[model samples]
Target: MNFRIPIFSLLMIGFSQSAFAQIKEEQLILDRKREPEIKKIEKKKTSVEAEKNYPPREKKIEDSLNLRYTVTDVPAASDFKTSTIQGEDISPKFEAENLNNYFQLGMGNFGRILADGNIGTKLENEIEVGADFHVLSTSGLKKEYPWSSKQNIGNVAAYLNANGEKGKFNVIADYGLNDYNLYGIYALQPDADTDLKQRTNRFKVNGYYDFYSNEILNNVRLKTSFLGDHFNAKESQAEIRVNLSKHGVELPVGNDVVLNADLGLNLETLNTDFAILQENSSKFLNATVAPQVTFFNGDSYLMLGSDFSFLNAKNSTANTDQVQENRTYWFPKAELQFAAADEFKFYAGVTGGLQLNSFANLLETNPYLLSDQQLRPTETKYKGYVGLRGDIDQQIKYDFRAGFGKINDMVFFRANDLFDTSVSGNRAAYDYANSFSAVYDNGKVSEVKASVQYFPLANLTLDAEAQFTKYDLENYEHIYNVPLLKAGIGAKYSMLNKKLHLGANAIFSTDLTTNSFEITESGSQPNVFISTENNDDKVGGYADLNLSAEYRVHKNFSIFALGNNLLNSNYQTFKGYKVLGAQILGGVKISF
Candidate 1:
């Protein structure tokens, strides 16, 4: 027990010494942090002690452990502020006005009058229906002649269209009437007025049905027409057509391709009473099949196809048991197109087809035809062509084509008595040699065509085109009424906030061969006639210029003026038919 007390006392002494050492180290750390303040405090103490002359006292444990801290000042922040914002006002929208219905009226010199109008409406389910009418007439011209030069034409049409999902269709019905006096050839009969005045009527119905996303069968077309003149010349026809297309068609040596075919059937009946032709009426039945295949590669495509057709013809007035004429044809429709760039292409192709001719078509080509004219089909044996189509730049585009064609049964217009001038004639209204006759011949034609379109400005467009054709007729002395060169220039411009529109076009045609005949009295009692032919005689070689302008005075009203034959010269359209002087017409147009 005595030994333990000494050991315990010794341990307690060591622990007290360790604790005192730690407290002293903490005081030293405080003195180092504020050494200047501590020195000042010590100096003040010494001064006080010296002034009072008092003895120094020993410092205790509390004095050694005392600590002090300094506090720093911080500035205050300002108040928060924000500005208010206002929203902009929105403009009201108005619905657009309907301008589908329109009308036009005009009057001008040479006793001209024009009137036309149209009205239409949109029905439910994407359907549209409309009707329109047109009328034009001219009354006074060439008073010095014994005959009257008067013309009148009128037309009316109605249409219905429907657009559906993956399919669409349209149907149209129209009628036209044209009345005029054949004053170019004056009649020798005392009452020629009754024979000279004639009228033509035209009626037609056309329809089309199409499928947008169809793969096998895509489109169908139907047409019916009846056209006739006062001279018992009439043509009535009905036709139906369908298009078949298929994609992803498998091939033996290559990938899938596309196949397309077009099938058609047509029937026609015609009638004509001629002074010379023994058979003046006919009937026709035509069937056609066109099939094509398209092979595609990298920027290149080849379309190979052929058109095959069968035609049957018979005399309209003949007995039902009569044998009909049967004809068959095959035409190539092949082309290879290579795209050199995005906007340019080079293509070469061969095409040929048969065109059926009728009195209506002949009348359109030559208005003066004998009623007893024979009708025949024009056969295009072959037409080979090479073409380049591309855009020059952003604003200009161009197309150039050169082709050669061989045609059979090409029709030409010739004077009535051009070949035969026998004194004894039918003495009919058209037998006076003043009328024209249709002549057919086989010929070869080489042609080159070029066209360019330039959009110089946003609202202006300029177009120019030229065509040159060289004809080769074997054994025929002349190719009548065929122009060697044809060209035209047209321009359309809109200005003044797009309220004024101006259009101008000029057409130029080269000289053509025409038959010139002269009549001479060879007898005193019978007044026998002798006709002479001028083989080198020619007609045409004129530039026809026309200009039109329209100014929209209001949203629904416009003022328009047009000047035709602006050169102020006589324009001969046919061999003996000449148009009046420069015609000026002014009118108003309305939109509702």
Candidate 2:
């Protein structure tokens, strides 16, 4: 009975304990479910509180302002104590020197003598006057050749120049006399001791005037000349030239046009008488009018012009033969120029004209010509040329030119024939080997020329020139006495503060064709029966070398020495002629 009661208490206690465990399990499940909802609500409340505590902030700005500044007045200048400093003098000093007049005298081998004098003066109003005189004489080298060779030459010249507000004026007068003996025939006629004397005199007067006005006519020139020989041959010429020119005529192409006109009048007369040849007289009247137009810019230029000439000539001889010619000729001249750079230029031209071949000109070219030569005018039909000139580095200069021309009645020198038996020795009187006769030939000529100048230093200079000429004759087989090639070179040097100067020059020429003759005697009067056979000869090429040196001893005094033909080459410039060998001259010069 007691066992039943204990069992019931145990059962009830166990049941209660089971019910409490069940209740605890249910609460744990409910807490797990409500944890997420509680956390969500707390997070929402924290975000709202944070937003309310820290509201949206306003934007901030920075302030920048400039400060004002006041400038003070500058301090007034103050006066300091007067002061002076003295030092050694350092100024430029100059010496005055005058060397307008000079006198020179010299003597050398072969009995040669030289004398020269020059004087010049300047006056108020820009007037200048000057005079010059020179004399050169040489006697024979050998006594046996007394009549073989002798020479005397003298010249005098004076000039006057004046400059005024209007323009310039100049007058010049000159006279020259030359005397020489014919010695070319001495080798053939050694026993015949006859002195053949020849003398020539020339006189000239020239006047020039230039006007500074703005008119077209600007310049005028007048010239008169007279030439005479020992054989009663006389020639006179008078010429007048007037120029009209206008410059700076603007053109549409930004160039300038120059219009120029030239008017010239010339009158010439010649008279001569020979023992064997008849007397001859010639008169010529020449008038020319030339008009030209030039278009020029700074770098290029072109010139176009034409010359119209009216010539009237009359030639008469003692044999009642007369020739008269009156003609009008037209010559066209044109030139083109271009400057490629500052130191280079190219130029070309085509020109043609008639040149007067007067007796004075002939005598000047060949002093040994006989007085009985005929006179005529030379006609150049056409001449065309192109040339280039330039400088290199401002120290050297060069020029090259090539040209072709056709000439009618070109004159050349030829030996005369003296063997005519009918002249009764009259032909021999004037037919010496030294004498030359003028001959005419029509031909075409071509020439090439080149020149160069170099300055290696401030006081040294050198120059060289070369030329080649070719001729195609129409009627003749050869051109007589004309060299095919010519060349020259010269150099000058100064040193010792310009107190010492030296100069040297050399010239070369090719061989020339000339006529010679062989002497023959017939079986009769030996003196009167001389005859000659024609033969051809050649004058060999020649070179001439000359040197000079000078040293200044004082401010107005100097000593100089010169040597010619230093190589002693026995070369002849003309057929049957002999030139002097080495010759030396030394002298002193005084200037004041």
Candidate 3:
């Protein structure tokens, strides 16, 4: 504003205005150059902070963009070769073996010799055929006794068996021959010569057939046998049976039921040529039908049945007229079983039947039986029994039973009269002092039996059994020659991987009462009365011990030795007959 605007002011003002304009222009250029760098730095800083909060977004794929894809062809399977893989050799360590035939031979004291053989073969049609033979012979102990007691027994059997899809069939034929001397008489004048040679022959044939179908009939069996002796005694028997059974009949109680039926025919005939016997020929015929039904639940079972029998018998005798008997009998049977637990069970039953006692049967039980004795059939009216049988543990099993029954015509053995004044020179009717006669009595019997088996180890077993019976005779004061108590104990042990076996057994029996006579002088006449002072009417009790050992020399061969009556106890199974003492036998067995 000075009138005189100085040259300096003008110049300063102009300089200031120009300098401001230049500064503004320079700032614009610098900002323009660094704008991209500054924006990048800010964008990075924003991205880092966004990433911390959320994941970064994926890039968008647009359809408009052009892309390329490549396809490659698969290789053909035929281009490669296949191969089979091989495995290591694996063979069985044990051999394949079978045992179907065997042979045994033995010798012992008392001049005993034994021989046995078996041979078997299988045919191409799957049928099996076999044959067996056995012989046992013993020389007499005449050095100790006055008579020779020699014996020889031989047996032969042949069998054929066939198994098919439908059933199994078997046929067997057997024959037995026995030669023995009756050496039981010792008091007949000491030098009385008697023809005591005896010979017996037995022949049998049996057939069995079973069906595997679901039909009512299942099996059929047939048996026929003939027995003859040199004493003009002959016996023959024949039997045939058919069985029908069906199972798994459902009941309303959600249980199953089973039914069984059996029909059989039996025929027997016996003829004896004893001069003094009244009856010489006896014949018997029986037809029986038995039907049974069983009902089973989870742990209990009931069995009910009945046996209907029709029996006929005819006897022809010299002293008595010919007699014929006919009878019909019905035997009812019922049994109940319940398992209290897995290892325990209780059972009870009632049973009855008619048993045929032929001369052959009587003689089989007692070979010393007198030939002229009367033979009759036995009738068991009824038998009731209760039993507890089960395993106490895995290794022990026990069974106990008690029964009572009545028997008609029960057979018993009695010693023949030793002294008969009627007969001259101590020669009685029986002629043999050690022989026995069969007697029949109607009696009631009560019996108790118990048995125990223990298998503490796989290779060791022990067993014991005891039986006691009491008889109330209807006609006799006592049951003659019937042991009141009988007991047996046995044990078997195996060692060395079953290569060695040891066995021991003991048998004991109580004393028995029998009738015996003594010779006494009465007014120069010999008198016979029952002995009372010499214990001759009583057979003393005895215990017998038997021991056996077997050692396997090879898989197919074994050696065995047996010692009988090892305790050397003087025992008599039959009165007046002493058993052998301390006898040993050794043998070898070979199997194929």
lDDT score, residue 111, model 3? Answer: 78
- State the displacement of the C-alpha of residue 255, model 3, in Å, after optimal TM-score superposition: 4.2
TM-score computed on alpha carbons, candidate 3:
0.77
What candidate 2 gets wrong by more than 4 Å, as runs, is 1-98, 140-146, 190-192, 255-276, 419-429, 523-535
Model 1 ranges off by over 4 Å: 1-98, 186-195, 248-279, 297-299, 315-323, 418-428
Models sorted by TM-score, best on top:
2, 3, 1
List, residue by residue over 35-85, the lDDT tens digit for candidate 1.
Answer: 111121222211111212211121111121111000001001001000000
- Candidate 3 residues lying further than 4 Å off, grouped into runs, are 1-98, 186-189, 192-194, 255-279, 418-430, 519-536
TM-scores for every candidate against the unseen true structure:
0.76, 0.79, 0.77
Better of 1 and 2 by lDDT: 2
Clashes of 3: 0
* Residue 441 in model 3: lDDT: 95
